[model samples]
Target: MTRSHALFILMLSTALPQMALAQAPEAQSGDADILVTGRAEKLYRATDTEIGRGSSDPLDIPQSVQVITSELIRDQGARDITDLYRNVAGISASQYATVTYRGFRQDGNFYDGMRGDPFQGFAVPSLFSIERVEFLKGPVGMLYGASAPGGMINYVTKKPQDEFAASLRGIVGNYDRYGGSGEITGPIDKDGVLTGRAGAFYEHVGTVQRNSDTSSLVLDGGLGVKIGPDTKMTVQLTRYEQDLAGRLRGIPIDEDGNFLADRTWNHLEPSDYMKLNGTVAQMRLDHKASDALSFNLSSRWFRYKEDQDYHEPRPVSDTDGDGVPDTVTREFRRQHRNIEGVTIAANMIAHVQTGPLRHTIAAGGDWYWQQSLFDGVSTRAGVPPLSLTNPVYGLVPVGGYDLSNGSVERSDTRSHRYGLYAQDQIDWGRFTLVGGVRQDWFDDADPVTNTAKTSGKRTSWRTGGIYKPMQRVSLYASYSQSFEPQDPSRQSASVGGPFAPVASRQVEIGAKGELLGGKLQPTIALYRIVRRGIVQVDPDLAPINGVDQMSPIGEVTSKGIELTLAADITRDWVLTANYAYNDARITDSAPGAAIDNSVGGRFPNAPDHQAGFWTRYQIPAIDAAFAFGGQYVSGQLARSGAHMKGFTVFDGSVTKGLGFADLMIRIENIFDKTYATSAFDARRGAFVGRARTVFAELRVNL
Candidate 1:
């Protein structure tokens, strides 16, 4: 064998024991009976096993749900939650992100199924201590007040484990970007019931775009206590900071809508705008009341501030007759509003069996409140000469005339939301029935205008069933309804005042099967979703799309099929794959718009074809493994040709464990694919996604 192959095999042999010990596989009995063992265990379906009868298993709730496990994250070598979602199933997302569910994009994200909002426009979840990502599709109104119909994604953080363990990991990759992260989890007491886990990460990210770069620092820590009985409690803290410099650049398109020839880094020499910075602080608490009940509460505080210099030619129609040049400079400044929020929730389950009938009832209630306070000042950058006559270019600058220093008003507002929900599962013979109902209420303390601060109340429900005629096959279907509040963040007075509430309905039918001695699991589903009373900006209030207008647009519908498969073909080989086919379109609009244009056109950012697969093989003799995976998304149009277009990308990784540390090498966009991460303005087309890049990491455990 070649020297490299021999070395790889040698490394694998030495790492086997450690790899096997990282996680204990699902046990048929014993400690596995506990419900809150690990976040991933509650979310991920390791095989074809159906999570029946409990609210803890979100999947059994009859709503669309996607879970990205810690194993998947490790294999993919993802640094952030964004990278993880790129490969998730039945989900399409934009770069200008919002915390949301399903394919509907919202800006609100959560932690451990609790509330987490953007602080200073940069609150993307950092994966420093994350365990798994759960995308709960549809309105989670029962658990989170005022949620978007699109749903919400909750990052379940990694908590303290029963055993003593420690790991230190480092990465170096493209753009001169480098980072290191570490974690330690173990018992703080002799009983091993009280445990602590701490982790931290920092990185200097290079921007391929000229005059642009991002560097970040993050710290996370947590402690968990197991009480004498069945109760447990946890407390955690997180702090993060990011800085962006240069001209936050994006791919430019030609008049014909063709991508610019320049895809390589550094094509534009930034002319005006300068630097930006963002920081955030978050804290959380999780408590389990008993084996059948639990409660969670969390809070976060965020602040953002920015300054920029805008330069351009003076507004002179050759008035000065200076044909050569008439350059003038304007300074721009922004003080971010502060965002703070508190969330509290409870969940419970009641299970009983009588004869051949089994019944499990799950119920819960939640309340969430958040407030945004704006306070800051923006004025001319420097003192301008008091004179306006004989306007000399450099001699005396005009004070108030400097558009750069214009001051904007700031304010404070609070919103309150609450929800109560219940679900039941009934089993008879080989058939199972699931049904649920939820009531949601949303109230705004600051209505902006005398528009009579409105209160929205809605009842959402779902019913579904599964049939297993055979030991290896099952058939299932479900119909669910959800309603969401308008975008409160970007709400203009008119839209938020008179606009109708948006409601969504979904119908799905599917079948799941296990083949080859339960070694392979496959699922096929077909679903249709319709949204009504969609909210959109009132023409009169269109204050620069994507920037100031956070109002709703009309209505839309999306239909598609999802296919997923996972298997262990052999004892040492594992495979996973998923595919989605979506047809999303705007259904209705206001006024002089074209006929089918508003009702039948494609929805922006929803790709027609999306698929992914990953396979891994372990050579038992050597403690080493090899894995490969990639995703493909077909071209898609944003806002019906308003701007976005179709694109695709692929990613891959490889890893080895030395005697003392594990080494991982990853290639993102392995084909060097080019595509849009997001595009807000059709006028600007699509903001290109990341380019082909590579990274390597070495991790040591103590």
Candidate 2:
């Protein structure tokens, strides 16, 4: 055998145990047909959720829910939640931290079932203290107030445990990448009345793109107190800082809409950078007055500050009439922003028998407030021309920016929202019905003057029914309506008033079952979503008054089928797979819409076909685990009609169990494929996918 093959086999023969100590798989009963529901009972399979039904039985719920458990996160070596989206059916990745669900691109991220955005502009979330990520599809406005109509993604954080445990992990990879993380959780008192946990993660990594590197530091700590036999309280705090010395705006496409010749070529110099610093504090109280009644109250406060200094490629010209363009103009800009928000939610659940049915009723109220301040943007400076064929750097001095040129722009806005909602789940033998209604009132105001700029109100509802044909199988159908407030700034007095809120409706039918004693969990859903009142730019108004006016006449629809499965084929085998077929199209638009934006045209970044699979198996003979996975996304068009290519990437990893430490080697993009991930029109170019990358990690648990 070759030396490399011999070494690989040797590495796989030595074993100890899995190193993820935060969560341990539950011991199953000897009965192979027994049904089970627990967080880690079957590795990747989830039994309950905190998002839709508040830890209710999955089979009885009529909503589509997906989860990424801790075991899956560790085995896949996912550093951020973004890396886990593919495992969830029907979720399409858009640029930045945005994602498309049900045909609508949205920024509807949450924290612990509340309104909190861990990732800000140009920044990503750190999974240092996260336990599991939950995806709740369809409209949640009935519970979450104003949000994207497509769905919502919530990040559940780890809490202090009564059991004592600690772990330390380190990672090293190509491109001079290395990082480490440490975590500890245990009881602080001998009586076990109080518990505490702490974790920290730090990484400095570079990418294949020139001068594209990022450094990040994240710290999390939490405390839990058992106040009484029926009441408990928990608090969590997190601080994060991430910096990029060089911004990766994306590769600039050529005149013919072709991607840059060298994907690694970066037009922005290393001197340009962005920094994001954020802090969050949250507390929750759980109280049970009786077996049929309970209360959950939560509050969170967050502040995020961002600073950016970057250059953008602007107005391009061919100089000559030829279709092949050559020269490019760049614009240099700087900005500083501050975002602060607060959210509070109080919910009460009660179970009671009425007539021949048992009812699980939930009532809640939420109060949310947020304000943003932006300033310190210098005047846009002109830089030397660039070539579409070849590029030159260092022509514009970093200090050449003139802040006194009066081109700076600033805005300070604030919003206050209040909501009240009530839901009822009626159980009648093998049938379950759920109905909910919510009313939300929001006021957009000036942060400094506290003057109301605009106000609006919305009422939303969702209803569904689940029928269990078999003991472990359920068929369900649901319909929901959602609304999102429009930006107050978009309201021009000349246009009468603020545009109507973007509204959405969806009809979904699905099936859920746990086969093989709950070792195999599957959910399949077919849904159609319609969104209206989307605002778009009007070129006629912009030229008429020198100010762009937006018209809210855009509409779109999405129809798709999604299938997700997680299975424990054997004692040591785990698998997760997903597939989706979405047909998203524009149904209506304004007169000024682009050629590609006509009716029946495909939606931007909404791929027609997407599939992903991941699996891991432990060979008792070798005492090690091997995993392989791949992702495929069909080609899609940008909002500006630029067609971005699609791609399929494969990844593999080998995990070894040592006496004191677990070791892992992972290779991403095994074929060294080069492809574009997304595009925001041809001028801004496309974001390139990660090239072949190799990383190794050693995790020690104590």
Highest TM-score: which candidate? 2
Tell me the tens digit of each residue's lDDT in model 2 across 361-431.
Answer: 98999898888888855454555666766777787786875656736677788888889999999999999
Candidate 2 regions exceeding 4 Å error are 1-41, 254-257, 317-323, 376-382, 387-390, 446-452, 535-553, 590-600
Which pairs of residues collide in model 2?
none
lDDT of 1 by residue, 261-364 (tens): 34443322233233333344444444555554555444544444444432211111223464521222223334554566676666666666779888777677
Worst 10 residues of 2 by lDDT: 26-35
Backbone clashes, candidate 2: 0
Q: lDDT of each structure?
A: 0.58, 0.78
Q: What is candidate 1's CA lDDT for residue 130?
A: 78
- Consecutive 10-residue window with the lowest summed lDDT within model 1: 26-35
- Tell me the TM-score of each prediction against the true structure: 0.78, 0.90
Top candidate by lDDT: 2
